[model samples]
Target chain A: MLLEKLQSAVGAGVILPDGHETFVLNLGPQHPATHGVLRVKLTMDGEYILRAEPVPGYIHRMQEKMGENRSWSKYLPNTSRIDYLSAMTYTHAYVLVVERAAGIEVPPRAEYLRVITSELNRISSHLVWFGAFLLDLGGFTPLLYAFDDREKILDLLESVTGSRLTYCYYRFGGLCNDVDAEFLTGAREFVAYMRPRLAMYRQLVTDNIILRKRLEGIGRIDAELCRKYGATGPVIRGAGVANDVRRVEPYSVYPLLDFKIPVYSECDCMARYLVRMDEMEQSLRIVEQAIAQLPEGPVMGKVPRVVKVPAGDYYHAVEAARGRFAIRIVSDGKEIPYRIKLRTPSFSNLSLFEEASRGMMLPDALALMGSLDLVIPDIDR
Target chain B: MTPTLDELNQAFLRLLTPAPALGTACEMHDATSCEGKGVSPNPAPTPPPTSAPVPPCRIVEGKTKGYHFDADLAPDQIVPAGRLLDERGFAIDAVTGVDWLAAGQMEIVYDFYHPVSVLHVVLRCRVPREGAEVPTLSEVFPGANWHERETHDFFGIRFTGHPDLSPFLLPEDADYHPLRKDFTGAA
Candidate 1:
């Protein structure tokens, strides 16, 4: 009866035989390794995780339901809160979908501006992931180094976007305001300064023998598995699929600017780490290119006071720092949406953990989760 | 090489020909014309009186590059159509539900994309609001397990063959489907 109750508690898939003894560990709805309020019910055979199930939604705010009730313009603020780490991309995708549905035209300069700031936000997000992942693996110094670099990007973004973290800058057709020349120069200097600093990161963390051993050959998720699980961003690229939404389904000014989609076929935690590391450089490149090609035009598009989407279903996807962030809006020719869904990247990326972490050591499982770079609120949203 | 929108439409048409007995309904059209015409060649049978008027299925062209194919399928056709896309190497990007309370129907949306060809397809299917159920795509695309569960959590739509239909992104004991139009958070 006790065994049956345990089986019922954490799904039958993780159940042990009648006589065998295995410990079921609850690893956080409030634990540091999880990075947020994410709980993992691990069925362990000694230190090896036989099955891992993640229980999310501690932060669920019903953002989608909130979207339906609020007017089209009123819902803009909620987008950033969906994924605070890459708030710009979330807000950008939300605006793009609404623009597509309402037939609003964004100015060329605004498109370029969106690209620059969004890419900078991507770099900052990757920096956070790097720091948090290393911190999870017991390296205290790299988190400090990663934050120092991230702070520079944040300062650059904050000058224009207003709020540093959960940005609500991107407007319906364009941006809330235009960026200044000082911001451009700071961004350019940061790019030049970051290239060598990345090389130093390779030397400090990437070359560290202990870090290498901890990541290499751990959490091997191949190309097919990634596709099967809808894993995106560095996780899919690390598995050798160059499936970045920026390249796959070109949006904003991504097609105009050129950058490589970093793919490391190793399919391990190290490969994901390297992909993020390489992607920060590529994001820097995109930002540099956008600033060079910056055009002079109005930042905000000439949008009508009352925003109404034609009765239809519209979808838009953007490449966020973690993966593909998509917004699907079902509009009913009114200011308020009939239904709204935010297809967040962290939700799908974290879904793969249960399958990927099975049969792995507990510490390696944490390493795998860290490499996936989940923001639990994003998953909950 | 990427298949043109016409070829993609034909592929879906083939999958739904002589539609199965689950009251399967579908409509096929040229992607560009669907945007302007606002009409389907053969609309689905009139929905039951209790259900709202069904919007004619549309196969509109995607505005963005690489987002080529868009179609509306009946509840039963989703799995077979999904299987064909899975075989063609389209990864399931997301599965979500739209609660059309006025129409008395729940629409399920699935987005898929080809890795190499970069062909994005949006498939939508609708069921009555009272007993919303659609065939699960989890078997066709294993990654859809969570997406379907989340859809279940928000809209209370059931994916017929889903392995695990437990609450996802919601507390286990929560009784309300928060995303439904009728849910006013009064509990």
Candidate 2:
């Protein structure tokens, strides 16, 4: 029944033209390898995949429709839910767009604080991806170590934002509250503690021969493919483009601090893995610099209680853990938005999967998906 | 090395003018390399062309608007604009639709971003609310396939040449356009 359904839905393309038999396989909606409720229909001939059609929307929440109905301030919390793994960065994009459209001025201290918290959030998010990705590759040991390190970040963020996972901490022009001295000291200590662990991770997993063999030449997404598919974050960086929102777009206090954008030209799974691993260290550097340059002022900026965005469209983008998360708002000079569009990176990243995974072994395709570091809700949003 | 944002801005400005001949336009583009090398640093001595085919879209300050360039184009001009952006190494960012029920019109907005130069351009086209249609950009930017589909699912704006117009982020059997302001969730 499943084969019949898939064959009819996907059409004659599923059956090979040269009289070889092909079977349809559903990867998820319940499978653990998928990370969330994403379903990819694979038309397979023996071990090789003929086609990979990702059928997303099992977790679709119509978040954009909800945005139009909610008032400006009332809709802020929804941003955190878009991509729960890197919730702070999603919130950063939302708040930045709103602040920019309304012409609100954030304090220098608040900008620094935003940078510190978001970078820490980025580190924590990457750690989750590290563990989850290794777990996908059948390595249980790294998952434990990655999560153990990730817990420290969650604890530090929880102390300040009061939420570990989906933090609704950022406001229109600034943050909801200030980071205390204890939080600062904790962040500094965490950065110092994380550096050695990253090296340890490199020694333990990155240098493993079996792991390298599995990922090195698998899923070769060249620079032109990335451009055609709009792949970014570590994916494009892995293809030798030094494209980073912090460096290119220059948001927050990033220009005031210093960090390197890791680029690896291999355009394979290993290259993406290396780029992300290097990015964690860079994020930590940013966190440390932001803490050291932490200015003194109120965390929240002054503005009218109800933010009435001017009658126009506004766009803002930030580098999330997965890639570039952008938000577009069409306001009618009212408290309620006319339309809201959340351009989640995972959506664009996953869109390229079908084209990239064509003609690959099933296991290799899964490895490529793991390298993408997708959060399904972000795609379905 | 990649061209600076200023060079890209100049390349974009040059492409906006109506090409006198296809061969001549290609030669002019070849003369001003997409990379920073070989392109003149100074502005053109001649005044801007007044007889451009499409309405002029100016590159603005990134501060006032969140993006660098904003172009309001007719529905037919999107493909040409997308082709020029693709040639200049800009990636398709997002395709969004805004329903203007009061104005009885719908707006389809396409965003493009240059990975190296960090320039962002937004192209917007307004169509009538009923039977709204625009040319597909998927041929130019394959990345636009899903975005265009998602926009269609939300606003029911047809991309005439899109390969697949099926539901994205919506149930396969869904018939309602939920993002439209008039949609009230009634079965």
Interface RMSD of each: 3.4, 10.0
Q: Residue pairs in steric clash, candidate 1?
A: none
Clashing pairs in 2: none
* CAPRI verdict (incorrect, acceptable, medium, high) for model 2: acceptable
lDDT by residue for model 1 (A325-357), tens: 888887657679877878888988988899999
Q: What is the DockQ of candidate 1?
A: 0.42
Candidate 1 residue A134 Cα shift, in angstroms, is: 0.3
State the lDDT at B70 in candidate 1.
Answer: 68
Poorly placed runs, candidate 1 (over 4 Å): A1-20, B1-4, B20-59, B64-67
Over B1-187, each residue of candidate 1 has an lDDT whose tens digit, in order, gives: 4465567777776666556632344322221122333323334444344444222233555783225566677777788888878777778889978775655667787888776555778887767788899888998888999999999998899999999888877888877798887888836
TM, every model: 0.91, 0.90
**Residue A155 of model 2: what lDDT?**
96
Pick by DockQ: which candidate is best? 1
* Chain A superposition TM-score, candidate 2: 0.96
